[model samples]
Target: MDCLFEILCWNVRGLNDPAKRDAVRVFVASLRVSIICLQETRLNVIDDFLVMQCLGPSFDGYVYLPAIETRGGILLAWNKSLVNIERVSFDSHTVTGEVVPRDNNRWWLTTVYGPQTHEEKIDFLWELAERRSLCPGLWCLLGDFNMILYAEEKNNDRLDRFIMSRFRQFVLEHEVKDLYLQGRRFTWSNEREVPTLSRIDRAMVSVDWDLMHPDAILQALSSSVSDHAPIHHSLSAAFRPKRRFKFESFWLNLEGFDEALREAWVCDPGIVDPFRRLDALFRNAAEYFQAWGERKLGNIKLKIAMANTLILRFDVAQESRRLSQAEAWLRKVLKLVVLGLASLQRTIAR
Candidate 1:
């Protein structure tokens, strides 16, 4: 299938805060991925409004395994315009669905949020094996597995060898090829002086699935808030189309709007005739408005990116030492800025 299909798997830690939701939505919009698999939502209920907070309006279809009293949760949302879900089912740890992308055949996608305890981890693997038997066709799995296949996957060089062996054996027996992460070595981190980093999140596909989507690539994306880095899996490397420019009505209410337009109109267009001069004046005013809008309003996307960068900087510093009161407050303010800008972008798009 040459049709493009992309999935974003993230362990958001929690989605209860509006700022966190806005950050997720902004990142999701930038990537333009068709499907989203979020783990550890920690929300007892997943509603349309809550889902909108993360995926926006386009991704209207979803199936979630709710959190157990503020614990684990999994949410799988897809854009209906890009992919049609034939069937969807969920359990305690996963949300499985049969997805059919435009001009492509159907395949099974399972978004997992594995357990932490060793006993629970064993059961999680067993459940996956059972699910694999049921979905014997083209299958692809992605999420925070909460376990690594090798010691090198962790920074501390420490792991339960027995558990690692079992996980590796499962992958081999099931023929689930663990797709190589293209951008980063580790996906999770514990922010501390002596930090622990591990590659717990992954994207794995069955042999037949790989044969169908040979061009598929997995990338570890940077996260602003979450401890786990989101992984993006795509079958094609297509660039997203640029958004259409529109004159925002809110711009007309700005303090210097009239003064700016008058200044542009007064500019000489090097024209002699009165009629031609009038046309030139209008052209100049249009150009002025576009430039003025950009300056006054600023590019929301760029502002959001800057805010994320600042937040990440603060987070990285916190790994070694606690931020002072001023820095902590500034970090919180930056998050709010991101949330507000994201909401503004949505309004402009609408």
Candidate 2:
């Protein structure tokens, strides 16, 4: 049996606006949030502790912990109902604590919004990973990751890949699983013409933690007041199987390309001889179709069989021309072989 749980994380940008702060109060009051984290407070004279105290009556005995704020500020406001609020990293920043009495407690919640500079950011990620390692089970890490996993993750012309590489390596070394790249698109938006968006804010956990709370999910909420959207999620005592993202369809949707590929295929030169060339073509096409079926519809073997049936039974050329699922079709082929397949289709070369 799995136990259901709920959690929230956000980079409020700054804890300034009275309405925004009040909204925070209402949001906290509304839910049974086990863990709550915030970043970029942008505080001047107000103390971090006092700001945390603002969640006073709603949290019912909570604690305010600060992280090494670069310019603005970072805070971790936890619910007493959620866990035994104990301040771990306080005096500077990077504050974390243990959630109490384990019936099936998978991870200890730790929130951080690291610095922008490479050196400072690296230090923050390394330290956070180190702290997680100490626990050695399930550790839920949240706040502005300040980094992205893929090229699609960022919207800027300038993405520091070198620094991002280090950050990604740290994630791999730490064995943390990113939750944002699952189904959602962009989490934070610069709100431009195309809207420069990136998943700077995210949540992640260990494999063991995934095993405990299977239903854990994260989504960026609308940032009506702040620049960055608020991230909301819930967890449960269920084990969700690792679902691969449908990244193929993204590649297949190209302009005036499928017809060219088919022409190229017919012109792809049937590997010598007469019957052998046809056999090879059908076999290759069958395999590609099968692989595509497996990815989109599960059952690789069955999918392959179906592809074989389609190629062997149906009018392959006509079907291929009318392939509304061109992306899915090419993806399966691309997955199987890498030779001369680049002409299949692509996403405008990044």
Candidate 3:
């Protein structure tokens, strides 16, 4: 189990409007957010009243980098009771800090608003990579990155290979991974006559951070007020009961499963009232199945990730030239593998 806390990140576009600020306050309260990161606030300065109106009464402390005229700004706020934050560094594009939670566990968090232009975007990536070297422990970078990881993340436009490559390189260099997202696939929209959607807003965490908060999830909420949707990061509560035993579909494909089940079912001692005996037998079988599932399906996530990577590679290759016969067949096989794994996961959930 993990200690549950929710962090909400949004571009917000601007918070100067009273209605927009009220909407933000209502939204954050509704979500029960403990921490908030707002970008592109478009405010030259933040006062106590503005903070109170935007973040509400729950948040006790906040830090802001004021916007340069009307262009860029970043603000980070956290619940004083839940998180004790110490500012680490700040600039127009990012604010880095050390966050100590109520449990006394600490991590480094960087909230960013990447530059819009091509040259500036490249500089921002390099700056981020440099900053990553400062603190190596559980780290998370979250906010509007202003770029997408893959072509599929954008719709109604051709992918920008150069920008995508730079973003990919930054991830690889930093050894950070995108947390699996829930709800909407795209987090930002162009708000045009024909709207263009892209998942530019996201949360990326180090491998160490994932290990620390294994059950954390990122959700893309509806873009009700701003062009960019707010992203919520939720960590599970620390106290959780032992998981109930559930059958795994993949176990049926493994050898000796039936034999194992039979052995558990029949190896009952003589304390038998018929109903109690049956109950004991099933309990034993469930224990055996649980152990078996752990051994066999433990690496399923990694396997699925590998399959997705291969599929992505094939799709990218297909854009420029035809795939070879072997490549085409492998792509089909990988897709099936991914689908099968997903189906097995759904079965396990039931």
Work out the TM-score per prediction: 0.67, 0.59, 0.68
CA displacement after TM-score superposition, residue 97 of candidate 2 (Å): 1.2
User: Which regions in candidate 3 have their CA more than 4 angstroms from the true location?
Assistant: 237-350
- For candidate 3, lDDT tens digit of each residue in 1-350? 32568899999999889999999888887887778999999998987788999988778889898899998899898888878788568855899999888887789999999888899888998888878888778899999999889998998567778999989988998889988788788998889988888999999999988888877888888788999999888876345689888766667888888887777676457857988888887888888788876776776789899999989999999999999999999999999999999887777668
What alpha-carbon RMSD in Å does predicted model 2 have with respect to the real structure? Answer: 19.9
Local accuracy by lDDT, each model:
0.88, 0.62, 0.86
- What range of 10 consecutive residues in model 2 has the weakest lDDT sum? 339-348
lDDT of 3 at 208: 84
Q: Write the residue-wise lDDT of candidate 2 on 1-350 in tens digits.
A: 22445666777766666767777776666666656677776654445455554454544444444333436466665555545554355423355666662353434777776677778776776687667666666577777777777787876757878777887887788887888544557778776777888878788887787776666667666675666777777776246676543334542454534653463245247367878877776656555544553444354345555555554433465566654477557655644533222322233133
When sorted by TM-score, best at the front, the candidate numbers are: 3, 1, 2
lDDT-better candidate, 1 vs 3? 1
Evaluated at residue 248, the lDDT of candidate 1 is 79
At residue 321, candidate 2 shows an lDDT of: 63
What's model 3's lDDT at 248? 62
- TM-score, cand. 2: 0.59
